[model samples]
Target chain A: MSIALYFFAGLSAAAALGVLLFRQVLYAALSLLACLLSLAGLYIVMQAEYIAVTQIIIYAGGILVIILFGIMITSRLAGKPMQVSTQYPVIGSLLALLIFCALVLSQPAVTSHTSDFSTNHWQRAGRWLMTEYALAFETTGVLLLICLIGAAVTAIYQRES
Target chain B: MSPVLLYLSFLLFALGVSVVLTKRNAIVVLLGIELILSAAILNAIHFNQQFPDRMDGQLFALFIIVIAVCEAVVGMSIIIRVYRYYQTAVPDQINELNER
Candidate 1:
């Protein structure tokens, strides 16, 4: 399981990098799909099957399709690849490195938990969602609804204009 | 899993950031942003396994996914508008409003 997890992680990371490096928009989008799928795999490895499935369905299936549709409608394919400005590459890379280092160094080492995967994991999560964390869960749902409305309005308003 | 996978995830994330910062195309920059978000999600899940008592990490990942969806929708719409106005999606060429 650990080996598989590592493999999937590496695969995901590579695909993510590919998203950045690919010149074609479609290719970059496809690479994002790969990365998302691998993330789902990682979720499963963490014993979060629910999250894994949601990640696949929501991100890889729904959101990615939306992005691809946007690219299709916008006709970015016909345009030539853009050139990078030579002025800031070195500085940008250095800043990114510094941030990455800071993040890694600042994170405390995770303490290990010995609980094995059991059927009650979902039950516990459900209980928490309904009882203790119900408000937060409902708030997230409301946020999603707002975002959906906002996206729809943006799309429709643009079409009408 | 071994530490290599964790390192790889970090590397991918760094590459994505570089792409977003260096790329001149709006579409490509969005893709890079997506990549960076996924990397963060991956790390969260990885750490979640190390401490299974709390489902907070997984929940956070879920929220990130939702947020990413919203971001893509809005961002793509903006990109489309930019394309319509400028006839190009290149970041450098779309700077007409910023030019003095």
Candidate 2:
């Protein structure tokens, strides 16, 4: 289990690096897909069964598709591979490294690492969502509806104006 | 386990920040945002494992997933509209509306 955990974590980090380094838009998007899948694997190792599946379905499956569409529609077919412009590469990376140092220095110490990846959380999560997080669930539904309507309106509104 | 996972999350978050700052394409920028959110979500899951019975961390992660979805949808739509209007997906090139 520990080995699987480390493997997925390493895979995720590597794929994320690919996303960072890839200059081509399609390649970066594909790298993001790999990163997300490896993240799902990490979630599984961490006993987050629901999140693992959600990460795969929603992030990799759904959001990625939308991003692909955006890429396709926006890009011109001028016989050129779609490449994203890199701006302030050195400064951005330096700032990111500074932020990483801060995060590491401020990280909470890990005292007890639990190996409790055995219990099934599907039923428990469902119960809590319906009861304790009931308001949150309903609000999410409303937010999704609003997002659905809003995205449509915003996207099409510009065409007519 | 906990320390490794937390460090991994931090690494991803930093990478995401760099992606957002360095990339010019709207889709790639959005992807960077997704990476940032996912990193934070991973942290929530890490804590969820710590206090399994409380279930707060997991629940928060779930809500964040929903929020991320909404953000992607809205952001994509805005990107689409911007592309339609300016005929370019690079945010830096959109200078008409900028306060000069």
Task: Judging by TM-score against the true structure, name the best candidate.
Answer: 2
* Clash totals, every prediction: 0, 0
Q: TM-score for candidate 1, please give it.
A: 0.84
| CAPRI grade, predicted model 1 | medium
- Deviation in Å, model 1, residue B38 alpha carbon: 1.9
Worst 10 residues of 1 chain A by lDDT: A78-87
For candidate 2, write residues A20-76 as lDDT tens digits: 999999999999999999999988877788888988999999999999998888897
In model 1, pairs of residues that clash are none
> Which residue runs of candidate 2 sit more than 4 Å off their true CA positions?
A112-118, A157-161, B97-100
Estimate the lDDT of model 2: 0.89
Q: Residue-wise lDDT of candidate 1 within B3-75, one digit each (tens)?
A: 5546655776787788788777677777777777877777776677676667777677777877887788788
